[model samples]
Target: MNNNVYDCAIIGGGVGGLTLAIQLAGAGRTVILFEKEQYPFHKVCGEYVSMESYDFLERVGMPLSAMDIPIINEVKISSVNGNSFTRKLDLGGFGISRYTLDSTLADIAKNKGVTLLQETKVTGILFEKNLFLISAAQDIYQAKIAIGAYGKRSVVDKIINQRRVKHVSSEKNYVAIKYHVKVELPPNRIELHNFDNGYCGISKVDGGNYCLCYLTKSKNLRDNNNDIKKMEQNVLMKNPFLKKYFTEAVFLYEQPLTISQITFNKRSAVEDHILMLGDSAGSIVPLCGNGMSMAMHASLKAFQLIEQYLDENISRQNLEVLYHNKWNSLFSKRIKTNEYIQYLFGRKLLTNTVIAILKRVPFVTDILINNTHGSKF
Candidate 1:
């Protein structure tokens, strides 16, 4: 509210930003958080979190066990030709909607004394003279440090002059679609069904509903004349598993949530004296279905680094270098490997062959899936 300089200022109220805010506030630090949207809203996401983050979320004040949501431990995957395989997940996961999760975290932070600014967007962040000058709706505030947790894309990236991820002419962009439905899928299983140029994942979230989300190249929609239903029939229904759900499921939303230009390119951990967290830093290809856990994990690392920075225990350069190194150590190889995996899925011959191989040697499939996910944190 006032122009008093804060110890830390966070942009975006997603999991990463909210986790950092909760940690800082709980530590008795003066923190201010800015969010462009109100709580209890939906976003285009897979809506499943890896088991790695289950304990940490409980520590952050979410009553996961008490929520009585789905605990998913089995995986079922199908290829475009309808060939499918099922396996037991190495580490199980749970599902919850962002609408409920984000709002709950916001409440926890507010109770912890975090100065949360709702429906307020951070327009630009400028670092000058060892301080961050933040601009939001004609108001400029100051903070010792700024965290960029803004999801997927934001004008703040351009203001910081960060390089955009380069996509080739043929495969330059992708689109994501999400919807909650009343499907007859099992509560303990997560499914990934492949179709032409895309894949769909289904899992149960709270309220006894299922999250049916998919990612596909932009060209698929364009080829279908920008009609989602047409694209589904022509491209996705090729997989019998997906066809069944699309036709038989009870759609809960009038219109599906969609986001375009989703890119999984390399980005810096720290930029312009600001630490980038979550999707703002780098995104894991969604086919693996663990992006939520990665974002929450990165937030924990960011909070630790910020504490060292504010306490003067580490030099500014050291803080930047440590966070950068830590991020790469934990996620660099995983992102690169998933990028290749995404490319592999886009090819028909390769995907079918891979599925055949996975069916023959089920242990190999477990190894591949484990590579994309992290251990319990």
Candidate 2:
């Protein structure tokens, strides 16, 4: 096999990786990106990009308005007990299906001169004196900088022996199932309905369809014979609000896409020669409702450090240290905050109380939203 070399090689062509490739290529660096999957594939994601991601999307030369998806301006939270609170979202977020968003970003990366290797799965990384070798299933490539934008799980993480926390029993070990459904829900609103053991969210996506998804502890579904339909009917339908939607809503896609056994524990940013980004670095609780923005934001941080090192403005050791420090400084507090909020949401009573308080002092809701989701970038 031919050994091709580039200034930077990115594993995983997810949002973070694609964004970084575009940014780096735009800045006059040669970047090659590998993705195991082809474009327009659906992943189990909320498909909502907060207002914070608008600027980044524009900077990357992707048109948000061109997508023709809904723009949501309000967030509504409801309890299983029927107490509800409505907060005008501090900053409106955009909704586009991952099928569209991912393809759009990939197109932008290609247009910006990023070498994209589709259907390529990276098998391992080899570290050496001045360059790192990246081995894919079929070929090998080398680069001065290697980025782990691989999203969630990859062989690079294991090769580096990155830190891992012992799994602890928690209510957060839930399954998320998302569906594209045809519904008459408001185009500018996102709804969150709480149930006995979990919560479900419904919002408009691009292409005039709604994304209905839920997260529930695995045990709840297991007790129901691991039947998703049965669990939705028995447990989810128990919520009055969800019952109305599920009964009336028409599923647009064939079947729901699911991600099982999701964990939100801490992870190190720098591992071996690869710098982790997006969910691979660390994920915030889904309740925060802004992981999309976080992933895009991480690409910006990764690009800054990478640009400096590639330009010989900093030493490799210092770049790794600085990347880790910056990653922790900017995101550690937010992750911890989300963890605390997740605990509160895990308990039904705390969630009700928090919603009540937010309803009483509406501004508190805005503050909470701003804190949970950083200012628009």
What does each candidate score in C-alpha RMSD? 1.4, 1.7
| Candidate 1 structure quality by residue, lDDT tens digits, 1-377 | 25799999999999999999999999889999999998879999888888999999999999999997899999998888988899999897899998999999999999999999998988878888898999997798899989999987887887886554455464848889999999999899999988878899999999999999999999999999999999999999988999899999999999999998877767888888788899888988888877788888989998898898889999888988999899889998889778878887855677788888899999988878888999877
lDDT of each: 0.89, 0.82
- List residue ranges in candidate 2 displaced over 4 A: 163-171
Instruction: Show the lowest summed lDDT stretch of 10 residues, model 2.
Output: 159-168
Which prediction has the highest TM-score against the true structure? 1
Error of 2 at 97 (Å): 0.8
Question: 300-354 in candidate 2: lDDT tens per residue?
Answer: 9889988999889999999999989988887888888777767766357776777
